[model samples]
Target: MMRCGSVIKVKPGMLDEYVKLHSSVWPDVLKMIKECNIKNYSIYYKDGYLFSYFEYVGIDYEGDMKRMADDPTTQKWWDVTKPCHIPLETRKKGEWWAEMEEVFHLD
Candidate 1:
């Protein structure tokens, strides 16, 4: 399995709504995530910053990500959630969440 982490900022005053939306994530979107070989996904927020972590079990990470991006339900889910996000200006092209490098891991 491969571990991944990313971060993004939430628009001002949008934290409550964003948290509410995630409290009960759409079923289809969850299914798509699992189908893409992602596991142990979690999101945390602090000072407007949203941090995400997950494990990728698939052999083809890029392909799995592409498949997830192509899903209609996933696209619709993003439509609802994206407005609440303020992506980091420093993020690389085609990146909405700024990917973070792992500096240390105990497991």
Candidate 2:
């Protein structure tokens, strides 16, 4: 399994809405996530930033991500949630959340 972490800023006045939306993510979206081999996904908030973590168990991470992005339900979910995010200026091209480097890990 590969662990991933990412970060993005929540737009001002949008954190609550973002949290509420995530409180009950769409079933189809969740199913797609699982089908794409993403597990233990979690998002956390602190100050104005949102941190995300997940484990990828699939062999082809890029292909799985592409599959997830191509899903209609996931597209709709992104439509609803994208407005609440302020993507980091430092994020790579085509990245909505800035990928983080893992400096330490145990077990």
Candidate 3:
């Protein structure tokens, strides 16, 4: 399995709305995420930043991500959620959330 982490800035005054939206994520979107082999997904907020962590059990990460992106339900979900996030200025091109590097891990 592969572990992933990412970071994004929550728009000013939008943290509550963003948290509310995620409190009840769409069922189909959740299903798609599971189908893509993502597990133990979690999001955390601190100060103005949102951090995400998940494990990918699939053999093909890129392909699975593409599949998730192609899902209609996931796309619709993103339509609502994406606007709440502020993309990092240093994020690589084509990236919405800035991918984080894991410097150390235990267990």
- Give per-residue lDDT, candidate 2, residue 66: 98
lDDT of 3 by residue, 1-107 (tens): 89999999999999999999988999999999999999999999999999999999999999999999999889999999988999999999989989999999999
For all predicted structures, in order, the TM-scores are 0.98, 0.98, 0.98
Error of 1 at 13 (Å): 0.6
Task: Record all residue pairs in model 1 with backbone atoms less than 3 Å apart, i.e. clashing.
Answer: none
**lDDT at 83 for candidate 1?**
96
- Candidate 2 residue pairs that clash: none
**Residues forming the 10-long window of minimal summed lDDT in candidate 2:** 15-24
**lDDT by residue for model 1 (1-107), tens:** 99999999999999999999999999999999999999999999998899999999999999999999999999999999999999999999999999999999995
TM-score computed on alpha carbons, candidate 1: 0.98
Question: What's model 2's TM-score?
Answer: 0.98
- In model 2, where do residues sit more than 4 Å from their true spots? none
Full ranking by lDDT: 2, 1, 3
lDDT of 2 by residue, 1-107 (tens): 99999999999999999999999999999999999999999999999999999999999999999999999999999999999999999999999999999999999
Please give the lDDT score for candidate 3: 0.95
* lDDT values, one for every candidate: 0.97, 0.98, 0.95
Model 1, global lDDT: 0.97
